[model samples]
Target chain A: MSTSFLHSFQSEWLKTRRSLAAWLVIIGGFFLPFIMLVGRTVYHEKTSAESTSPLFWENLAGQCWQFMALFLLPMGVILATSLITQIEFRNNAWKQVHTTPQHFYTLFWSKLMVIMVMVVQFFILFNIGIYLAGAVPALLLGTVDYPSQPFPFMYMLKTSGRFMLDILPVVGLQYLISLQFKNFFVPLGVGIAMLMLSLVMVEWKYGYIVPYTYSPYNFFELRGSAMSGSKDVNIHWLALSYFAFFTVLSFVLYISKKEKG
Target chain B: MHTIEAIGLTHHFSKEIPVLENIEMRVREGSIYGFLGPNGAGKTTTLRLMLGLLRKQGGEISIFGKPFEKHRTELLSNIGSLIESPTVYGHLTATENLTVWQKAYRCPKNRIPEALRLVGLHGTGIKKAHQFSLGMKQRLGIAAALLHQPSLLVLDEPTNGLDPGGIIEIREMLRNLNREEGVTILISSHLLPEIEKLATDVGIIHRGKMLFQGSLASLLLRQHQASRIAIETSDNAAALQLLAGNGLDPRIEAGCINLAAAEKPAIADINRKLVQHGLDVYRIATVEDDLETIFMNLTNQ
Candidate 1:
């Protein structure tokens, strides 16, 4: 059983690795954050605000979250999810896989594991891109004094960590959507629409319930602001709860539904 | 020990319409059982039900003497199948396709090359399945089915897209597998001639009903009386008159007269009568009972 599961997992990974969409997601992971960092650097260089306070790092992390939620993370999730399901739909490969002695859970989890691994890899690479984009330029040009305190390493780490944690809800939701929808555009469109709606609600006093709104909220200290007052709402917990709930729900649907080859 | 036994098996896609009705089939341990049918004749549905691909609405299916639904993995482990078209990753090469299934089946590493060679696709390594012709793809499909040295191989339309050479090659390969390894095979095809060549035992299905099921000899014997004798004569008018006068109003074809009879003496009598009548008996021969004829006769009734 273990051998069969491992083999299925290996085959699923090989299929993903060979996909053009997987490569695109990986490339976008590196490219998007680099572009953000470069833009921040050029702006900082022009303004001479190089590392003005811990708020600078918080602001940079906010930018990263916004960029990822808008395109990078959703694209990565779609690519990974579609990579697994499309093969079955296109070639009717599930019939062959199901005919083997391997159990259904083995096949299901193998494909699921591949998607999870890809999402994790995208997250790590995106963070690395952000670190390089900001850190390398700061070192090259040196930190400049500004009106507030300088950006600290602890603040940068915390901000990056927060951004990574906030995106989990989107990843989980996209995973569910991709599994359910055969049309590629549906998930992409739905994700973008939800993100945009959350962005719109961010300005309202009650926008803390909007998942993407809280995604960028924790990165910076609102400082007696209305958004800060809603900190007790804890977007991290909401995100994690949503992630766990939907992941289980999607898994149940997958296991319970009679798979048609 | 039968490789497969489905007793009173029934299934339906919708509640009102049953796709398979009280299907009782037994595939002998090591024989090539041809599952004959027309389109939508429940051949695929029967295979699916036996393999536990679909939930059975009635009755039980056992593979190698164990219930299939209750012990699906164990039963499936010893059986390999190609349900419809070849289910292989087009992006992967032939070797990669085999490797994927090999891993899934957890078969011995040594069997991969042997399976490929058995299907006569041994040397086309690294050629992606998309690059293969329909014939190669079908051969690859068979190789995948045979990868685990399965005891029972169930294939549906295994030779659908093959050229004449490919068809002959697969027929020979299947015969070898049955003979050399003693693997039992349950194959389904609409082509009667192909099944007639490969099947030792036969099951004919029409419109979701099992019309006949038995050894080829038994099936042939059952229709032996329905067998016809054809005779060609220089004068068709005189031959028809001679045959009718003897109460053997033969069925007429373009250049021959056909009479349904089991006894050669009756045909010989008709031939001798024709010759004596100066009808010039050109040819007198017995037409062997083929599956097509039996299929037509069975389904028509």
Candidate 2:
């Protein structure tokens, strides 16, 4: 990277420290896993018997993602992206950043890169949480037998990778809208509205066009509960396409905007 | 040499209303240029255009003898500005706020405390900007602007909300920056007295037009022209006619025959002429024009 770009990125990175966006990442990453750990401990008798099944690890992963793919991940993306983009607006600092020596490209992309990196951090934390949730039961309670089936490391990694791709369009669009409006609610409202619309149209044949449905549908398909129509569409490729289109559109609009602040 | 020059700058929000029209401004190197204007007179717009915060609708802006648009990033590296309000992050301390810009300006981190010290914010340790008073926030904003040590400083109403002491502190700081460090400044404010106290040069803008632009001495020269000598005469009507008839412009203002501030010899000549015309010149006194009056006259014109 150029020195200017590196500096811009570093500056943006510092802004996220102790911010609402940072808190959201920490809390959002661990909330569901913490709940699962409690749930498994509360009902160890039923879980210990099911632990011997060959599908034990897969079932546990599926259960963890059911609500996550449906709401938490999508909502987390919306909140995190909006919170990060709104930092400049909240403090009335856009003109300050614009007047600096950095190029517009550096300013725009460095912010987007920070949000993306935070998302990666969230995923890493969530994965660690997931591992602890699965392993802590066997380690602490003698009554609970460790799952006889080998841990599906490759399957888990692949699922996490797919979920990351599946959520990119939501991130791209949220980042775009958040950059345009100063009121935090506008982007947050638009994201929630779009996610709701996608959920409503999930059974429609062309529902794959709505990028927000990609994550949830991917989860349902993996769990064999997907509607037959979803099998015909490659949601991942569509998500990638939508992500690229929105991201480029955002870049053009932002750099060309006359009144940035 | 001119540190900043704007020629024929024009902008309009709609076709019906132009915010700036055919503006011609120049800021000499090492000189403090006070951009004097009232509210909604496009002072902020012109500054925004110069700083590239607003896209120029027409004309050209050049700083340091180069086109602003073509050399924006390079030019901005040597230009520090605070437009309208202080844009400090309320979440960060003064030092951290300066560090943010230091990284962006690619300046050394040690310059942070130096800048804070210059703005008298060096002692604000770990206090978030939101916790600071409005004056303190404004100072932090200036410290951030000064972090890169730009050669030219463009401030739009840097003292808008400052108290008397805060205003004096800013004025002194700016004066020292110009006299000692040689930083050219283009500061905008509607406070005529404030500008009068600190500006080496003044540019009075009103209703989107360049009404006057020159040295403080030249602007004060117009202040003399704007001032009037009021005469209480026995026949004020006759005195008005007598002064106008002698190739002098005089008018009745507040029941007194008023003539533009003139040389001592001219005042004597007027006195003799009025007395010769059978008019008793009861009293002759100079009505000193304040800076606001001069500003009003220029902008109103």
Candidate 3:
């Protein structure tokens, strides 16, 4: 049984690897953070006064992680979900899968694991690109004369990890939504709508509970600050709860119902 | 042992109407069984239920002496099926599609090329499935199903969109599989002649009911014994009078008399009697029971 499951998982992973959409997500994700780092470096090199600021490294880290949360993470989620589910829906291939020796849970999990792997790889590569891009410019410009704050690798890692953790709930929810609706636009449309609504609620001072609002909360908390004038919100607890809820919900939805081909 | 059996099978899409009502069918091992039905006759539904793709409302399905619902994964492992149109990934190459399904079934790697060769698609290298013709796609579907060397193969309308040559090739392939490999096959088709050529046993369905299920020879013999005699005479009135006078009232249609007869001598006797009655005997022949006639007779009744 384990061998069968592994074979199914490997086959699904191969399919995802060959997909054009997976390439787009990985390339676009790595590009976003790299672009932001380059923009910061050029702006600092062109203006010596801006380079003199002590908090420049912190600001760059802030921008890099924030850009990922806002744009790259959601884009990756949508791409991964659609890539995993669209082929099955378009070709009606689930009938073939259901008739095979592999169990339904095994089939479902193989696709889900492949999507999760894509997202995790994108997260790690994007952060590393951002770090290298930021570090090289600082070293090339001579840190002694520039006198900018030291780049905090640990803080960046911490913040990016938290940001990724916060997005886990939406990842699970988007996966469920993608499986529920075979069309690619519905999950994306719903994510964008919820994102815009969360933006409005964050300003209203009561939106900290929303998953999207946690994006900025994670960034600010990394800099040792709170966004809503309250330090009572436990970032670790919130991230853990979100991950648990979404994972459980996704499992329930997947295993409890009959999946038609 | 029976390769497939469904006892008192029932299915309904909703509470209002039943799609299949108390259906029962059996197919012997190492024989090709043809399921004949018209449009909306619950053929696809029956296949789905037998494959454990749908939940049975009531009844039991057994495959290779195992209950399908309880041992679904194990039973399905030994069965290869192509239920509807081939549900292959269009973006993947023919080889890639086979690889994916091969992994799903966990069959040995060597059987991949062997199955492809069996379907006459051995050398189409790295071409995406979308580029295949309708016939090639159907063959590819068959290749996917046969990859695991299953003991039983279930195909629903396998030759739906094939040309005559493609159809003949598939028919030959199926025959070879059954004869050479000893694989039991259950094929559903509305094409009577195609089924007549391939199937050893046949089951006819109408309006979600099994009208008849038996060997092809028995079905033909049953229909032949209840034979209809068509007699054409110059004086139709005199022939009708003579036929009814012999206690055999014939159905009259356009100067011809059609009536059922028990023996061949009765036909000869009717011809002799009509000739003796001063009527010119034009034609006297027994109508051989074709599938269409049998279908009409069974369904109309």
Best by lDDT: 2
Each model's Cα RMSD: 4.2, 2.5, 3.3
How many Å off is the CA of A140 in candidate 1?
A: 8.4
List residue ranges in candidate 3 displaced over 4 A.
Answer: A37-44, A47-61, A131-157, A223-225
Instruction: Supply candidate 2's per-residue lDDT for A44.
Output: 95
TM-score, B chain alone, candidates in order: 0.86, 0.91, 0.96
Residue-level lDDT tens digits of model 2 in A150-184 = 88888888888889889999999999999999999
What digit string (tens of lDDT, one per residue) describes model 3 on residues B1-301? 8999999988888788888988999999999999998878999999988886776779989999888888988988899999889977777887888888888888888988898888888888988888888888888889988999999999999997788988898999999999999999999987788889999999998888999999998888877777778889898887888788889978887667888854877777888888888899888877777767887799788
Q: How well is candidate 1 docked (DockQ)?
A: 0.51
List the candidate numbers ranked by TM-score, top first.
Answer: 2, 3, 1
A218-247 per-residue lDDT for model 1 (tens digits)? 533332243642456777777778778777
| Local accuracy of candidate 1 as per-residue lDDT tens digits, B1-301 | 7889988977778788877888889999989999998889999999987876766779988889888878988888888898888886787878878888887787888888888888888889767788898888888899999988888999999997899988999899889889998999999999998988999999988877788999988887877766678888898877887788787768788677887764766666776788888888778887766658779889878
The i-RMS of every model, in angstroms, reads 1.7, 0.8, 1.7
Clashing pairs in 2: none
Model 1 ranges off by over 4 Å: A1-4, A37-62, A135-232, B120-127, B230-258, B265-284
Worst 10 residues of 2 chain A by lDDT: A224-233
